[model samples]
Each structure stands twice: as C-alpha cells, then as structure tokens.
Target: MKAVIELNEIKRDFLVGDEVVHALRGVSFTINEGEFVTIMGASGSGKSTLLNILGCLDTPSEGVYLLDGNPVKKMSNNERAVLRNRKIGFIFQNYNLLPKTTALENVELPLMYNPDVSASERKKRAMVALESVGLKDRMMHTSNQMSGGQMQRVAIARALVNDSAVILADEATGNLDSRTSYEILALLQDLHRKGRTIIFVTHNPDFYDYCDRNIILRDGKVVEDNRNKVIKDARETLKTLPEED
Candidate 1:
C-alpha cells in the first residue's frame, strides 16, 4: 500500500530568546493510506509540532517530509498551499465553523478556493457532505444555533466537502461530552471503514482503542509506534451508552 504521509527523521526547532527549544527530535513515521492512526502525547511531547508539519501548516527544520510521495520540503509556498487545500482536510477541537454562517454555507466555503468548481457544483457537493454526516435537515442552521455535537458534525462535513485524501483531526473531541465524544469517534470510524485516511491527535489514552495504530511521543521524539492488536469498535461502544436526553 502507498503511504499517505511519510516522515524521515523529521525535526523542528523554535527559538526562545537566546535558547533553542527542540520541538521535534528526529521523529520518523509512515502513515499508510486508509489507516486510522492516533498520535498520543502529553503536553510538550511535540504532537502539535508534528501535526503542523503533517498538515503543511509549517515546514520542518530538518529531514524530509512527504505527502502522497511528494516531498513537502521541496515544494514552494504556493505549491504547498495548493497541495494542502486539495489533499488535506482539518477537523479542530473547537469545531471552527463560522458562528453566523449556515451549515451548508460553511461547508461550501472550502469549495470556493477551487476555481474548477462552479457555484452549482459547490452547493451540490456541500449538500452531499452535510447529508453524509446525517445533518440534512440542519443545512440551514447556523453554527450558534446548533448544539456542540451538531457544530462538530458540520465541521466534519466541511472537511469532507473537498473530497480530501487525508483528514487531520487535532483533539477533535476535546470540547464534547463523553457520550458525544464517542458519537464523533463512531462517525470517524465509519469514515475510516470507507477508506479515508485519518490521523487523530489527542492526549486521551482511552481513545487509542479506536485506532488501527498508535504513535506515542515523548520529549519531541517517538517513544512508541505499534499496531493496535485489539481495536475497539466505536459503533458497538455507542450502543452501550445511555439514551441522550
């Protein structure tokens, strides 16, 4: 299988006054296509730094980083932006949807960056994404009008609107309740079952069971990278939750 993301001895450094802080120390890993991966770490473990590099939001200070076999370090800034927009979808913990915008409109925002998509096509794709997230009836609802979980669902729809190759979720369930967190995880599992490559970054160890692989980071380096032998079925777990009021 082809690797969706490949990192070779990746390193990142930040300057704090006269001192240099090493955010990532020669970390390396490959994420294969269609795999669900969780990157777990405590604060200052370099998970966020690694995520920025993976998302193409920031470049590494040293070593090669590849996305879909293309060397990210070699790409120009414009090229990187294009690649990010076309290939990567991001889901944030805060459900970064436009507060005043309708769910459908918010989902359609990403499509606006692609000149190849016409207005009608953008709307069509956005509607399909919303429907896939089971938010067909909430298309016209604004972000502030929806519950926390619903807002997150709309954010997921927005991420899927562009048909991105990989979904990068950064602490995606941090703000939700336990039951709602499982619901979101179950939705992510469903997406993974359909062959979407997902890279989730979270500090929660319990969520590791839902992933196919776990990569634990410590002090800016990979401490453990192992395949999860016993994966939890989020859908089944959801069934055991009490009825939502």
Candidate 2:
C-alpha cells in the first residue's frame, strides 16, 4: 500500500526565549492510505506536535515529511497553505468555528479559501459534507445555537467540505458525552470505510477501538506502534465477563 504520510527522523523544537524545548525527538512513521490511526499520549508527549506537522499546520524543526510522495519540507508558506487547503482537513478539540457564521457558512469557509472552486460548487460540496456529518438540517444554525457535540459535527463538516484526502483530528470528542462521542466515532468509522485516511490524536487510549492502527508516544518518542491491536474486541469481551464478586 502507498503511504499517505511519511515522516523520517522528525523532530520539533520550541523556543522559550533562548531555551529550546524539544517536542518531537527523532520520530519516524509511515501511515498507509485509507488507514485510520490513533496517536495516543499525555501532555508534552509530542502527539499534538506530530499532528500539527502531519496536517501541515506547522513545519518540523528538523527531518523530512512527505505527504502523498510530495516533499513537504521544500514547500513555501503559500504552497504549504495551498496544499493544506486541498489535501488536509483538521478537526480540533475546540470546534474553532466563527461564532457568528451559520453552519452552512462555516462549512463553506474551506472552499472559500480555494480559488479553484466556484461559489455554487462550494455550496454543493459543503452540503455534502454537512450531510456526511449528519448536520444537513442544522445548516443555517450558528455556533451559539448548537451544543458542544453539534458544534463538533459542524467542525467535521467544515473539515470534509474541502474534499481533503486526509483528516487530522485532535481530541475531536473531548468535550462530548460518551454517547455523542460514540456517534462521532461511528461517523469517522464510516468515513474510514469509505476509503478516507484519518489521523486522530487523543489522550484517551480507548479510542484505539475505532482505529486500524495505534501510535503511542511518550516524552517526544514512540513507545509503542501497533496494528490489529487497534481493532481488538476487548470491550465486547469485557461486557460478557463476570463482575467482581
């Protein structure tokens, strides 16, 4: 299978004045196309940093990153921006919506950034994305009128509106209740089934049940990388087990 994301000897450093803080320490990985991956880690573990680089939101401080076989390290700011607009979708813990913008407009924002798409085409694509996220009826509703889960769905719609090949989500269900989170995960699973590539960063390791691969990071390094384990039916087995006597 062809790799959708390739990271080689990647590292990211942050500057607090002259002091350098290492966020990613020589991490390397390849994510195949159409795979759903969960990156698990705690604070300062570099999972978020890695997601930013993968999503093209930030350049790695050192090492190489290739997205769809294109050398991302060589892309200029404008080129990277364009690539992100077309090839990558981002879902955040915070919905990051324009509070005053209606759901339709929010989902349309990505298309608005791409000059290649016409206004009519944008609306059509946005509506399709909204439908995929099961938010078509709430298209005209603004953020203030929606709940946390609804806002997150709107965000997912906005992410998918650009017809991006890869989706990068950071704690996409952090603020929602268990039921809502499960609903969101089910939507993501359906997208994965439809051949969309997904890289999701989460503090909750349990989310691995929804993924095809799991990447575990700790203090800027990977401690475990597993497949098959991601789809294990442990929860189902646990439900049938005897409780403490």
Candidate 3:
C-alpha cells in the first residue's frame, strides 16, 4: 500500500515566555492509504500538536512531512492552505456546522472554497455525500432541528464533499453518548472499508479496538507504535447495544 502521510523526525517547539517548550520531540511515522489509525495520549502528550501538523494547520519546527507525496514543509502559507483544502478533511467533536444552515447547505460549504466546483456541482456532490451518510431525509433540516448524532453525520458529509485524501478526526466521538459514538464509528468503519484513509485522535482506550493501528504518545514523544492484531467491527458492536428510549 502507498503511504498517504509520512513524517520524518518531526519536531515542534513553542516559545512560552522566556523558556522554550518542545511539543514534539523527534516523532516519526507513516500512515498508508486506507488505513484507520488512532493516536492516543494523555494531556500534555503532544498528540494534539502532532494532529495539527498532520492536518497542515501548523508547521513543524524541524523534520519533513509528506502528504500524498508532496513535501508539506517546503510549501508557503498560501500553498499549504491550498494543499490542505485539496487533500485533507476535518471532523471535530463539536460538529462545527453553521447554526442557521440546513444540513445540505452545511455540507456544501467546503465546496464553496474550491474554485473548481460550480454551484450546481457543489450541490450535486453534497447530496451524494449526505445520502452516503444516510442523511438524505434530513437534508433540509437545520442544526437546531437535528440530534447530536445527526449533526455529526452532516459534518461527516461535509468532510466527504471534497473527496479528500485523508479524513482527520479530532475526538470525533467525544461529545456523543456510547451508542451514538458506536454509530459514528460504524459509519467511519464503512468509509474505511470503502478505501478512505482515516486518522483519529482520542484519549479513550475503548476506541482503539476499532482502529487498525495505535500510536501512543507521551511527553512529546512516540512511546509505542503497534498494529492491531484484531480490529473490532463497529457495525457488529452496534448490534449488541441496547435500544435507546
């Protein structure tokens, strides 16, 4: 399998007052295409810093980062933004949908940033994305009118709108209840089966069971990197959950 993300001895530093803080210290990893990876760590563990660099939201102080074979470290700010917009999709724990926007409209927002997509094409793609997430019926509903799970589904649709090279999810299931979280995980698993690369960041150990690989971080360094021998099927797990009232 080809690698979609490659990090070579990446380092990130922060200037806190008169002292220097090393957020990432010589970390390196490669994530292959279609792999579902989970980055796990405690507070102050630099997992967040790693995610920021992987998502192209921040530059590393040292080392190389290649996204889809493109050297991210060599790009300027505008170039990085363009690369990020074209290749990466983000899903937040809070389901950052615009409040007054309908589900379809919210999903269409990402396409609006692309100069290559026209209005009609954006709508067409957004509809397909929403339908894939089983949100076709809720297309016209606003955020306030939907449940938390529904909002997250809309967010997922938005992420899929660009057909990105990788989906970077930051605590994507953190805000949802257990059953709802499983549902979201099941959706992600489905996407993974369909060959979409996914990188998930979480503190919860339970979620690691569903991922193909786990990278543990501590105090700005990678403490462990392991490939999961037995990946749990989220869809099957969902079947065992008790029905909600």
Candidate 4:
C-alpha cells in the first residue's frame, strides 16, 4: 500500500507563559492508504497535538510531515489550506453542521472552496455523497430537524463529498449513545471495506476493536503500534447489543 501520511520525528512545542510545553516529542509513523488506524491516548498524551499536525491545521516545530507525498512544512499557509481541503476529511466529536442549513447544502460546503466545480456539479456530488451515507431522503432536513445520529451522518457525508485521501475522525462517536455510536462505526467500517484511508483519534478503549491497527501514545511519545489479528464487525456487535427502549 502507498503511504498517504508520513511523520518523521515530529515535535511540537508551545510556550505557556515562560515555560515550554513539548506537546509531541520526536514522534514518527507512516499511515498507508486504505488503512483504518486508531490513535489512542490518555489526556496530555500528545494525541491532540498529533491530530492537529495530521489535519494540516498546525505545523510541527521540528519534523517532517508528508501528506500524499507533499511536504507540509514547505507549503505556504494558503497552499496548506488548499491541500487540507483537497486531501483530508474531518469528522469531529460534535457534528459540526450549520444549524440553519439543509443537509445537502452542508455537504456541499467544502466543494464551494474549489473553483473547478460548478454549482450544478457541486449539487450533483453532494447528492451522491449523501446517498452513500443513506441520507438522500433527508437531504432537505436542517440540523435542528434531525436526530444526533442523522446529523452525524450528514457530517460524514460532508467529509466524503471531497473524496478525500484520508478521513480523520476525532472522537467521532463521543456524542452518541451506544447504539448510535455502533451505527456510525458500522458506516465507517463499510467505508474502510471500500478502501478509504481512515485515522481515528479517540480516548475510548472500545474503538480499538474495529480498526486495522491501534497506535497507543503516552507522554508525547508512541508507546505501542500493533495490528489487530481479527477486526470486529460493528454491525454484528450491534445485533448483540440489547435493544434501546
């Protein structure tokens, strides 16, 4: 498999009033295409710092980061923004859909930044994305009109709209109930089956069972990186879960 993301001795430092905080300390790893990798850590384990760097939202103070083989540190801010828009899809803990916008419009938001896509083309692509998430019937529903699970599905659709190289989910199931979380995981698992590269960051231990590999971090360094011998099916797990009243 091709390496979609590569981090070489990445270090990030922050100045907290006269004290220097080393958020990520000499971290290195390579995430290949079509792999579902979970990044697990406790609080202050440098997971967030690493997430920021991976998302292109922040640059490392001392290391090399390559996204789709493009050197992140060498890119200008605008270039980085463009790269982020084209290469990475972000799903947050809270579904970050616009409160007043329809699901279709929200899914189409990312495409608005790309000058090559016409309005008609944008709508077409957004519809296809929503359909892929099984939300075509709810395309016109606003965020307030939908349940949390539905909204998260819209968020997932928005992330998929760009056909991103990597889908970076940060505690994606944090806001959901067990059933809903399992539903989202099932959707993610389906995506992974179809060869999408995914990087999931979470503190929740339950997530490790679904991913191809788990990378554990502690005190700004990698503690473990291991592959799962057998990945669990989220859909099958759902069947075993007691039905919600």
Candidate 5:
C-alpha cells in the first residue's frame, strides 16, 4: 500500500507574548492510501494543530511532513495552497456551504479553481458527487432549505468532487444528533469500503469502533496508534439506534 501521509518528528510551536507554546512535539506516523483512520485527543492534545499542518493550512516548526509523496514543509504558501486544493478534501464541523448557493453550485466551487475544468465539466462532476452522496434530488436546493444531515451531505459532495487524495474530516459529526451522526458515519464507512483514504480527527469515542484504525494523542504526542482487528459496521450500528421523534 502506498503511504498517503508520513510525519516524522513533527513539532509545532506557537508564540504568545514572550513564551513559546509547543503544540506538537515529536509526533510521527504514517497513514496509507485507502485507510480509514481516526485521530483522537483532548482539547489541548494537538490534534487540531496536526490537522492544520496535514491540510496545508500551516507548516511545522520542525520535522518532516510528506503528503502523498510531496514534502509539505518545503512548499511555498502558493504551492501549498494549490497542493491543498488538489490533494485534500476537508469536512468541517460547520457545513461551510455558501448560505444562498445551491448544492450543485457549492459542490462546483472547488473545481472553479482549476483551469483545466470547463464550466460544463464542473457541473457534470458536481452532479456525480451529489449523486454519490444520495443528494441528486437536493442539488438545486440552497443551504437554508436543507436539514443538518442534508447540508453535511452537500459538504461531503463538495469534498468528493475533486477526487482528492485524502478526505480530512474535523469533528464532522460533532454538531449533529446521534441518529444524524450515525448516518454520516455510515456514509463515511461506505466511502472507506470503496478505498478512499480518510483521516478523521475527532474526540468521539463512538467513532473508534467503526474505523479501521485508531490513533490517540496526549499532550501533543501520539499515545496510541493501532489497527482494529474487528470493526463495527456503521450501517449495522445505525440500525440499532432508536428513531428520533
């Protein structure tokens, strides 16, 4: 299997006033292509710091970070921006969709940055992405017209439209109800089964049983990183949940 992400002794430091705050210290790991991995930690454990680096939003102060074979630490801001756009699909806690924009238009936003994609091709790919998320019927609906789950699906569609190398989800289900969270997890599970490389950063313990592997962080360090021998099927778990009133 190809290594999609490789981090070696990664360290991130922040300056607040005259003090240096070490957010991540000597963190290292490798996430392979097609692997479904969950990164868990408490509020100050540096998972968010690590996510920012992995997404190319920030650079580490020390150590190496290889993303899909490209050295992220060596890239310029512009290069990193392009690399981020082309290689990583992000799903945030907030849906992050344009308020007045239709689902199809929102999904097409990423492709708009690419010179190679024509307007017609962008629409076509966005449609395919929405269809993959079971949102073809809601493609023309605006963000305000949809439920939380639907809006999240639209976000997922937008993430998928680029055929990105890594789907980096940050507390994706944090804002949803239990049933809705399970639905989203089921969708993520489906995506994983299809061989999509996913790196989910979350604190939800419920997520652990469903993922292929778990990586736990404590005090800016990786405390645990282990593959799951037995994984719970999200779809099956969803069936066991009580119906929402």
Candidate 6:
C-alpha cells in the first residue's frame, strides 16, 4: 500500500496572551491509501488540532508533514490551495452546504477552484459523485429541502467530486441521531471499501467499528493506535469483542 500521509514528530503551538499553548506535541503517524481511520478523544485533547494540520487548514509549529509525498510546510499558498482542492476532501459535523444552493451547485463548488476544469466537466463529475452517495435525484433540491442524513450525503458527494485521496471528516456524525449516524457510518464504510482514505473524527465510541483502526488521543497525545475488534464492525463490538478489562 502506498503511503498517502506521513507525519514525523509534528508539533503545533500558539500564543495566548503571554502564555504559549501547545496544541499538538510531537505527534507522528501515517495513513496509507484506502485505510479507514477513526480519531477519538475528549474535548481539548488536540484531536481538532491534529485534524486541522492534516486538512492543510493550518500549519504545524515544528516537524514535518507529508501529504501524498509532498511536504506540506514547504508548499506555497497556491500550492497548498491546489493540494487541498485536488488531494484532500473534508466533511464537518455541520453539513456546511450553502443554504440557498441546490445540491448539484454545492457539489460543484470545489471544481471552481481548479482552473483547468471546465464547467460542464464539473457538472458531469458532480452528478456522478451525488449518485454515488445516493442523492442523484435530489441534486436540484436546496439544503432546506433535505433531511440531516441527506445533507450529509450531499456533503459526501461534494467531498468525493474532487476525486480526493484523503477524506478528512471532523465530528461528522456529532449532530445526527442514532439511526442517521448509523446510515452515515455505513455510507462512509462503503466509500472506504471502494478505496478512499477516510479519516474520521468521532466522539461517539459506538461508531468505532465502521473504521479499521482507532487512534485514541488524550491531553494532546496519542494514548492508543491499534486495530481493535470494537472498530471492526460497530455492531459486533458488543457481541464479539471482549468486555473492557
């Protein structure tokens, strides 16, 4: 498997007043292509900081981060923008869909950032992505016309339309009820099966099974990074995995 992302002793710090707050401290990890990874932690555990760094929305204070073999810290603003637009896809707890736009338009938004892509090419690919997420018929519907699950599916279509190798989702199911969350998890799992690198930040432990591995963080450090039965089949966690010892 190819290494899609590689981090080496990544560090991030910020100044608040006279004090310096360390968000990520010497963290290191790698995500290969097609891996489904779940990052879990409590509030202020530095998971968000890690996600931001991974998503290229923020840079690290120190150390190296390589995404798809390119050095993130060395990339120029335009290079970073291109890398984000073409290589990384992001989903958030909130759908982040444009309130007044139809699903097709929203999914087509990212294509605007690519100067090489024509509008018709964007529309065609956006429609294909929407259909992949089971929302092809709802492409013309505005955000207000969809349910939470549908909105998230639209978000997924937007993410996939770019053919992004890495899908960085932050608290993707935080707002949904149990059934909706399960549905979203299933969709994500299917995407993973189809060979997309899915990195999901989830607070709910129940959905761990949808991912192949869990990277647990606490107090801004990784406490665990291992494959577990809990994340093997979320439903099977209770039935087959050993009780927490």
Q: Pick the candidate with the highest lDDT.
A: 4
lDDT of each: 0.93, 0.87, 0.94, 0.95, 0.94, 0.88
Where model 3 places Cα greater than 4 Å from the true spot, the runs are none
Clashing pairs in model 5? none
TM-score of each: 0.98, 0.91, 0.98, 0.99, 0.99, 0.93
Give me the displacement of residue 170 in model 1, in angstroms.
0.4
- What is the C-alpha lDDT profile of model 5 across 1-245, one tens digit per residue? 99999999999999999999999998999999999999999999999999999999999999999999999988789999889789999999998999899999999999999888999999999999999999979989999999999999999988999999999999999999989999999999899898899999999988898999999999999999989999999889888988777
Give the Cα-based TM-score of candidate 3 against the true structure. 0.98
Return model 6's CA RMSD, one decimal: 4.5
lDDT of 6 at 109: 92
Quote the positional error of residue 107 for candidate 2 in Å. 0.5
Regions more than 4 Å wrong, model 6? 229-245
RMSD to the native, candidate 3?
Answer: 0.8
TM-score of 4: 0.99
Residue 185 C-alpha lDDT in model 6:
80
Report residue 87 deviation for candidate 1 (angstroms): 0.6
Question: What lDDT score goes with residue 148 in model 3?
Answer: 94
Root mean square deviation (Cα) for candidate 2: 3.9
Worst 10 residues of 2 by lDDT: 232-241
The weakest ten consecutive residues by lDDT in model 4 span: 71-80
Candidate 6, 71-173: lDDT as tens digits: 9998777888889999999898999999989999999999999988999999999999999999978999999999999999999999999999899988888
Candidate 2 error regions (>4 Å)? 229-245
Candidate 1 has an lDDT of: 0.93
